[model samples]
Target: METDKRNLGGRPGITVQDVQRACEALRKQGRTIGPTNIRLELGRGSYSTIIRALRNLGLSASSKHKGGE
Candidate 1:
């Protein structure tokens, strides 16, 4: 199997400590803990990266249900 080129190269990955710091800061400020908010607080991470970090922190994406079966 071939790997996706997009995932081949980019800036260095963000550390768990970095994510934790941003999360703690947001919590201290009474902010919601979400990927977008965390990214904003970090000021330098991709959406996917932030989401992965959130997952590592035990946060999962909210699920959406279809209506009108």
Candidate 2:
């Protein structure tokens, strides 16, 4: 059965769900991963992507470095 052939261009690899799962795994280990780190782990370079995911999970992203400096 073949009819519509439309390619959604994207590199074949892990998905956002996979990224979320990985974040969960890190959380369980008491490890914190910022949006930047998440992007890196998911092989993505966009902070917006990571931030959106975290926000969806009710997690907040730091706007600056820790230590309140």
Candidate 3:
């Protein structure tokens, strides 16, 4: 299987600050802060890339859902 270039290469240009800013903007607008939403807000970033950024920001998806289905 061919590896996805986006996920197999060097560090993505996206920064934690960028993710934080996007999340803050979305929060102010009462929007959900998921990977898809963050990617849309960024205009450029893969799912994994956004997830990593979110992780760096200490806002990983797993951290949101706790002790429930």
Candidate 4:
């Protein structure tokens, strides 16, 4: 997936892989998977950028934990 190339706060780019990793971690912790949680997990990226990456992974803010009810 093509990630946002623009730099933010002097940090590197936020890639789909990054978001996927963050989401997985959040899932393991039973945490709410959203832009705010994700940003806190990664310590970077904008809400819009995180949202786009989550969409690419077929996930949303309201997504459930894998194999969970």
Residue range 1-69, candidate 4, lDDT tens digits: 244333332356787888888988988898888899999999988888888877778887667675573
What would the per-residue lDDT of candidate 1 be over residues 1-69, giving only the tens digit for each residue? 222112211677565566668777777777777777777898877777766666666766331222331
TM, every model: 0.66, 0.51, 0.69, 0.73
lDDT of 3 by residue, 1-69 (tens): 322222322565666667778887777777778887877898976777778767666787533322222
Position 53, candidate 2: lDDT: 50
Number of clashes found in candidate 4: 0
Index of the highest-lDDT prediction: 4
Compose the digit string of candidate 2's lDDT tens values, residues 1-69.
211121112444434455567576556655566776666656653566556555555567753223322
Global lDDT for candidate 1?
0.62
The lDDT of each candidate is 0.62, 0.53, 0.66, 0.77
Ranking by lDDT: 4, 3, 1, 2
Question: Candidate 1, clashing residue pairs?
Answer: none
- Candidate 4 whole-model C-alpha lDDT, 0 to 1: 0.77
